[model samples]
Target: MSQQTKSDYVDDVDVDDDWDDHPTDDELEATVENLEASGFDVEVVSDAEEALDVLVSEIPAGASVMNGHSTTLEEIGFDDYLGEGDHDWENLAADIWSIDDDAERDAARRAAQTADYFLGSVNGIAQDGTLVAADLSGSRVGAYPFAAQNLLLVAGVNKVVEDVEAARERLHEFAYAFENERAQEAYGVESYPSKELVYRQEGTEGRTTVVLVEETLGY
Candidate 1:
């Protein structure tokens, strides 16, 4: 068999021709509004870079922040910009299941529990404003609910689907596959556990905010 090089893999990839089935701008606008009505604060942006700027500006100083493990956010350079800031922010960027020391994991959980704001990405969000996420490590979804007083979700247009059914399909078919690849590349782990098992974790009561960018952001 021929050895598959990076360029060879890239060259062989076929793009999905699903654009023709995409909804119109008016439909998207109505969907956004409906999302807001369903108890989610949603903001629409033109691009990933703009979304990052808006996210940083919206967070106040002296606020603790928690981040989800998201390749999309990293691709857009959120960590670089966030690291440059001189605010009271705590980073919860650890593998959910690989914490060897209980004390260390406890400290990380405490930081998240006390954060003033939390930032993460959603696997999929429905037109009616339901946020969907699949996790193997409970960190990302676990910290979402009560980890902070305020919650901010950064999502790309690629993360949006028609409804819950489509969201679930994307989760199993696309989101999980991409997440597995990411985890392997970043942490050297191939598999963790059932995505459905991790999805059972729920966030605590907090003001949830979402920023949806027009461009593709994450898996």
Candidate 2:
């Protein structure tokens, strides 16, 4: 058998060709209105790099920050910046993983959920302003409900679907497969969406912020 190489799994691998679909202007306007009406603050960014710049300004200095596993986050350079950038915020994920002991690492992960800022990406966004996401484990989505002090979700405009049913299909058609590819490459195992989270509404006035990028990015 040929030896498996990073290039074989990641470089030349085929990704789904569904980005040809672009939402109309009416669709974008309505989706943004619906998202805001649903009580979540929404900001539309022009491109991935611009999204990164805006995100940095949005996060407060010296805040404790924790982020979930998200391709979008990596796409926008958050993963690299947060890990290596000389910033005032505490890198909770780095701190958690640095613990050599497995039990202590797990405990740190749980505690990090309550960080001042919890950043992540969502799989789907319904035109009605609903946010949909899933996780292989509860560690990621677990803090969105009420634990984290603040939440930041960055997604591409392509993730905006017609409705909740379409959102589910979006997950099955794109998010799951893309994530599985990443998991297989990184861990040598497949991944499934075991836990689901539908953010229907945000009761707090400014607790949740949604950054929507115009360019096609992530799954």
lDDT of 2: 0.83
Worst 10 residues of 1 by lDDT: 1-10
Q: State residue 208's C-alpha deviation in candidate 2, in Å.
A: 0.5
Off by over 4 Å in 2: 1-16
Candidate 2 Cα deviation (angstroms), residue 176: 0.5
Superposed by TM-score, candidate 1 places the C-alpha of residue 76 at a distance from the truth, in angstroms, of 2.6
Candidate 1 Cα RMSD (Å): 5.7
Poorest stretch of ten by lDDT in candidate 2 = 1-10
Question: Which digits, one per residue and each the tens of the lDDT, describe model 1 over residues 1-219?
Answer: 221212222233333324113445876787688777766677888887888888878787766676766666665667666666555555444332357898987666656754677777777766655667767866667756564677787877776667777666666765666566555656688644254421222243337777888876666
lDDT of 1: 0.63
* Cα-based lDDT at residue 107, candidate 1: 69
